[model samples]
Target: MKGRRITMPEPVHENPPEFLRNAAEPVRDHLLGAAPLPAFLHGADQLSLEDRRLLVDQALVLLEQNYVHLPLKTAMHAVNPVQRLRLLRRRMERQTPQTMPREWLFHAEMSEIFHSVRDLHTNYLLPDPFNDKIAFLPFLVESCTEGDRTRFLVTHVASGFSAPGFEPGVEITHWSGIPILDAVDLNAARFAGSNTAARRSRGVQSLTVRPLVIHLPPLEEWVTVSYIDLAGTARELRQSWQIVENLPSFVSADRDTAVSQGLDLDGDETQRAKVLLFAPRVVAQERAAEADESLPDLGAGEIATSMPKVFRARAVTTPSGTFGHIRIFTFNVSSPGTFVAEFVRLIRQLPQGGLIVDVRDNGGGHIHAAEFTLQTLTPRRIAPEPVQFVNTPLNLRICRRFQGGPGLDLGPWVPSMEQAVETGSVYSGAFPISPENGANAIGQQYFGPVVLITNARCYSATDIFAAGFQDHGIGPVLGTDENTGAGGANVWTHDLLSEFLADDPGTPYTPLPKGAGMRVSIRRTLRVGPNSGTPVEDLGVVPDELHRMTRRDLLEGNTDLLDHAGRLLQGLPPHAVTITEAAPADGALHLKLAAENVDRVDVYLDQRPRASVDLTGGQADLMVQGAASAHTAHLEGFEVGRLVASMTRDLS
Candidate 1:
């Protein structure tokens, strides 16, 4: 008699075989009335019972982890067991596909598995497990691939343990078909080499080597001493005779002083100390080569020399063998002293007849730097002006705190313009319009035609420079298209809670996000453009002459902007003209001007005016300047427009 086929239910166990059908039956039943399976699983008619079980188990795990939290009733009639399992497996694989080891795997099982699925498809299911560990694991895996598992073995397993005294039997356990450690001794050996390599890479030779410290006298005092390395000291010394022999006379110590002190009379101790300081640092970096017989010595001299200090300068040589040079003066954005000194230096160096100032790459550091630099360039000092502040809802918190009493209780100390003035803490300073703030060169007269080079890269401080120059009519600008306008005085504070947490307490405190950084402008700067009452808030300084370059021009390394500037300095005709005018027309005043060299000009009027008249030349038209509520005139020059102004704003 033929026996009827029996469909057994899935079995459950602590650890079930890979092909156990019964193991998945319970899970499948649990999920049957719950979540709906994906459409791709419908074709799993060919899947065997065991394969179905595997898929069921995986789906169960995902459900339990909140990865796929479907309602029970919906999941019940979702799909057949085979199709459901297939879909579950596909989804699981997408979310958490196995990651490739950072380097080639060499331990037999890992090696085989790594190579087998090297290009395996990954669906973004599981978070990357080896992201942060990539740097450390590559060396171990690569070493194993090279058949030099000794380092891997020593560093990972053996180094941390002691050797067993007696002979011992070894037995290995397999987890997920991968062998676990068979013996303690073998594991110890693997750890030893790895640790050593890691230490060497970190510039540490051994636990005994402590960081070297050199004590110096106070800032106002100088001290001298002779030192010798003690016997058995691990620290190494480097020789500097080569450097001493090559020292320039001015830098080297005087022979008489050296002789009187009984020091190496011919040597410069400063240079020698520098050489000696680097010796142990070099030795600490040596590592065992792949072929362990010899250690690879990375000698001190192998390192590249320190980079030379750099200063940017522009030079032009005339046909008559005469040369004109311009060196840009740069200062830290916030530092007032540095800016003042540099401005003075520039004033002294600039030729009386013509000069070019470049502030193309200056990222603003300090507001004081801008003020001082501008003051030095201006002929007279302007009175301290109030920088306007727009009070946003966010700023009200700071204001409340400033007005409130100090402490964890934030209030009563809210900063106001009056309070700032009383405390002298406001950023306001005298604008140098007086002779004291101007040039004091003895030889050449101060009057000269100046040209400023600006570009898109010119930022905060640079923007200020351009504005100041234009305000004083210092010089024409070259190559300033639309200047990057990032100014409003961002509120920066080291207080993390005050910044990020004040806005959001839910975010975790992590240094990665700048410890909850919060920045908002506390003041609005009222900048006077060619047109008045125009603020320099969102809009930056626009160049009078705008120059646009093509990729081909850039590739050719053409500094045509600079060249055109040179021509301008030589009294050549301007490439373009930008005219902005405002008058009244009809009963109300109207204004208009024209520029033959302009490609397109945009006229921005604050409001409609009484009388307006068109100028003959096609420049710009507006109502009376101050008469109108506000009028902003923007003029676009032809290619030649690139050379006229550093920045332009619509202020009518």
Candidate 2:
């Protein structure tokens, strides 16, 4: 069997393309890793036009690879043709410091190529269902290049398409290709003039005025490309010098034209008008709202208004004085500063008796806010102890300076007083405690029993406040069974990767150009109780007293815990006094007690007996002195109840 002889196709043109002339040799040299290729091949006199051209083609291939690999839309957008070319050159030449060489012509050409390819692929190859026919025509028109020879391809493709209500002259428009005219400048004409007018008109106006349609290249018709291909192509083109140099100029020109024509590019006519006419009024309104004093400054009022239905807090005061008066301050988890100051003020104003601070639904805020509140409430000042050095390092040694006098010239060894330094400690000296200057201006003279009411809703800075109070002996936490634990303390930075360019449906790539975000912990706070030494890193502060309530108590509107607290404050025993007879008849429970010196007697069943009780007037007949002038009690069946007796003194 004879092998077929391969025939190599001859070059169509005797002279290579300009880019090929400038790029080929440099690209070949870079591939060979001979001498380092110039950062910019276009400017180097050593590289021929062919070398630069070859380099560009090679750079385009590398750019295509990068575009294919782009995972995020933002990165794809960033790697425009110009950038792609620069990156390719850098990679090939192993340029240090990774600096992109500036090239204006390459960037311009690449930008145009990127947009054209992207538009074609998005509209022609992958036409979205949501796209309108009008937009489709414009997209095709915008994608055409000046050098394209097969101009009839676009017209042929669009000929069969029919859009209802689109007419040839009144509504529809057309454009013809012309050198030096950008897509934006290619003015669309209404319709072709009659045959008589075609012969009559001549020069630029003839083509400009007549309905002219630029043909799409036949090569473009065969271009069956995907989004990835278009995106890569665009990125490569954007890396070129031509596109990058004109970006700022293009943006500025567009802006200037828009402003001059009074065009609202954002299309928000009403908003734009409002901004233009009443900007000062809007600013004034904002300022006035900010300065509002009647508004709830730092806590629930702000949060409730901002986040209406999510969470809310209302300051509750009891109508009856039985439970005394307690101010329930609720704050949002975001803004603890306002609440901290308010809390500090409240603690300072507390009388020398007893105080019940409620933090039932405080979600949390800044750690500093909580710490500051604690500092204000703390009665004792705990300063950082100075560290002593036995043998200091030579680098840390201090030099002594002394002033010499006539008689004291002999005494040259004057040792300087060493200031004490701080060593390892949980709390830093950022905000130190001082007796005169550092003390809370409101003062912390309250020497009273402090109680804090907390629930599961209490979290973050609120938990910190509770912990600080408990740790510093500022207060005793009362209830905290249903509170949310501290979480989401560390702040995270967002890494945005892509630019949203247009409202079109079929734009190919969306990139997250950057890497992973940074996580930061703003500050460290201390927890309450015996574990004060342990930092509240991931754990929340635990409540000192865990009080659980039953549904029955809630339904009955009975605050048993509050009542118990009241009892404690009033110096009353917890259990009721009781007395029961060992023997009983008629299934009735009765208790009786007598004392010569006592005025009243109270009795409790299934509990301890008390001598103090008040009975109106009916209980006197049931009592009589029997054995040793002591009041006797009637016997009854065992039952759980309290009985009280009141007596008057016999003055006779």
Give the per-residue lDDT digits (tens) of candidate 2, residues 1-652. Answer: 0112212222323343233223222121111121111221224223233333444553343233322112222243343554655654555364332343333333333334333322101111001110100111110111111243211111111122223222121111222222323222332121111111111111112121111011111111111211112122211110011000000001122211111111111111212112212222322232233456232333421222222111223322222223222433322223334444545444444332444556554534333334444444443432211111121221012112112443112112112112213352222222111122222333243334456676544544455556566665555566535332332121111110011112424422232111111111212333435554444322445566665543222323225555434443343211111232222324433234323222334432322232334433313212222222223322111113321112122111
RMSD to the hidden true structure, all candidates: 29.1, 30.8
- Quantify all predictions' global Cα lDDT against the true fold: 0.30, 0.28
Top model number, TM-score: 1
How many steric clashes does model 1 contain? 90
- C-alpha lDDT of residue 419 in model 2: 27
lDDT of 1 at 340: 56
**Of the candidates shown, which would achieve the greatest lDDT relative to the real structure?**
1
Output the worst ten-in-a-row residue range by lDDT, candidate 1: 133-142
